[model samples]
Target: MKINHVAGARRLAIPLAIAALTLGACGGSSDGGGDSSDSSSDPSKFSINLDDCNDPDSATAPIKGTFDVGYSAPLSGPVAGAVELATAGYDARIAAENAKGGIDGVKVKVTYKDDAFQPDKAKANGTEFIESQKVDALATFGTGPLSAMVDDQNAACTPMLYPSSSTDAYVDVKQFPWTTTILPLAKNEAKFLVNLIKDRFPDGAKIGIAENQTASGKVQSEAFQAAAKAADLKITEVASDADPVAAATTLKAKGVEVVYHGGVTGTCGAFDTARGRIGYEPKLVLKPSNCVNAVEYVAAGKAADGVELGAFGKDPNAPENKDDAGVKEYLAQMKEAGVPDDVIGNAVAVSGWTQADLLINTLKQAASSDDGLTRLSVMEAAREQDYASPMLINGIKWFSQPDLLTGIDGFRPIKWNAADKRFVPAGDVISIRP
Candidate 1:
């Protein structure tokens, strides 16, 4: 994925984009109170009209034998290192599930493809999976690629299960009834950050946000700004790609007491390093969940120390979690799958494992339901999920409703201990109950 490196002037367009993507059809209430209507009791209400697709039967058809799934990920791109681990985790989980006789005695088979994190390639892969291959469902990683193919998935009425994206597009159940994601919503993340800032600085502190230029980055930045405005917290904004040293000086001069970077890994490291070099110490330095990797933060050295991260899963590599049964089982499974020891605890890999587990559980529910293991039943089961996975943080449940698009609405805040080169619990899990 190439960095956009857009100018600060581009910030003006973000609010408009947010209005279209966030406030229009794709997002929930700005107050964080999700749709209260209970529509899950009737599965028929969730069914889509598939008259326009090439083969609508694929969406309504039942499996006679094997349950086929088509998945695509960035297996050969700049993000491949982390994404491939997600693929490995997915493969390992599928293997484990098969050994246990699969979902309701029907073996689950996944056809994997490498999208290379390209939108066009991902769209092609999605079309092939739904129109040609006629797979039962679709799953993939990356927000851009998923956004590219979402229309096709909805058109075919194929269940697009557990796509790894933070974009608000997946949450518009009425617009894209076939799609749902396991990733936390950027809006929710913004709300969480705002609440944290208020709690840490009740007297109020000057805030600054280093906004990334990508579409997803813009969404996050706008979300935080919106939440902050709602809470009466003012924020100064900076482009994430700005000269880090200059950016640090400007922020310090502006009396910014807290700095939040909702961007990619490289920029996060650069900004942290610059702040350290310039001796600009903000009261709080925060990063998104995706930037929690040790290797990515290593370039920032001690500058990365004390940086807080928002995450949903327990870090398997953290020494404190070494005794966790879920962490132990994850390690054992990765080892069993012949994964390199060094790659065992990668966060993206853990997410892949988490997504696959969700898929397996949903399939089991669909298989046992009165509707039987058809595409409609699978989607119905997915929309009504309310369970806890071993891999997620304790007491943090994964759930969904017909109108609630996000599976997890909270994060477990962790801080990077640069000296220890691992993440440790910063505070209790913070969530917004809808």
Candidate 2:
């Protein structure tokens, strides 16, 4: 789990030296804006017209020292508890990177604000981040909040990296090129679930889903319906907040052989508990990737046993992954960063760490590129990344191509072992094509 500081230092230094040599050979400008004949290989290919979006005081110069980032999230609202765990991971990862001398010697400084999960507040936060705070980039949590401020971020021509949600808004490069998220698309998750059902029940089986009521939930529900239709599987839908016992009884009477809960952690827990109380046990129970939090299972108590979920990263607290190098490093870093011992292994915390890791890696790539760490270069690096993230599940690589902008390739199916209070790998990693 220990980092090789000397090797880490060398890794950062070598990239800069090579970039410098490459730039010199190509007769590029020191600011990395020189004209080049090969547009395809040009680092500035993704650079937007700053004049179109810039204000009187917009910062457009290439980063030479400190990398300033602005972050906003729901710090005191309904989702604050989950957001706080993510913040812990983000802060810990930043601390770990700074201890390693930062990305190519440029220390990262993040200014955080509480948007309280309100869209208007999120938009206002983005304005402050770009104008008042004068940060080079912006980051935030939640789909609705990020969606609320994306237009503003694009108008300001600022890079917004590693948002914590998987909404399709972040992947539309033609629309919001300044933003990208590390999370797998919710549609992709739906498709994977459909394929899983097809495999297990080749002859077809009755299915029911406890669906969320939010806008994002509607999108997810649509995806599921589309996938189910394509697979020729019948599925019944129920509102997530419906009386769980009543919902379970109705679905059971209808002979629902499988149940997929498409709500957040709380709803999932309540549904599972109600199903147990009503003595209704479907052949299989499925929860969305976002519900992989330990709190969900704890809330469901023994009812959560045998529940399955799609996960993109390893849970640090899972006994099977206790010896994993990535998990170990995360535990050490969280401990070092002063995260409480009990909260270190929370899946939400791990997700936050993963987001920070993605940003840190993207920053390094930008710094080493001929574009040399401008806001545009950071976005370019994020959109073109093609490497295995050490913090993710083994064998699941991060990739972004001209055609595929979401980056994540797939997810591993993990089953909740309530007896052990941990998630264990239940099946081989499932791949999803965009």
Please report the candidate that would top TM-score against the real structure. Answer: 2
Q: Determine which window of 10 residues in candidate 1 has minimal summed lDDT.
A: 4-13
lDDT of 1 by residue, 326-409 (tens): 888888888888988766777767877888889998898888876578776787778777777778887677887655655785
Candidate 2 TM-score, true structure as reference: 0.85
lDDT of each prediction vs. the true structure?
Answer: 0.73, 0.73
lDDT, residue 263, candidate 1: 67
Off by more than 4 A, model 1: 1-47, 50-54, 242-253, 265-268
lDDT of 2 by residue, 1-434 (tens): 11011111111001111222232322223454544432223442222234456661243357867889999888888678788888898899999999999988898998888998788898999999988987888888767788888888887878888886767756755456577876677778888998888888888888987776654555666778777888788776554546777777888888888888776533457788888888888899887787877886877888889898788887787677878989888988999999997678888888888888888988998887765777766766776776666668887877875324756787899998888888889998876745
lDDT of 1: 0.73
For model 1 the TM-score comes to 0.84
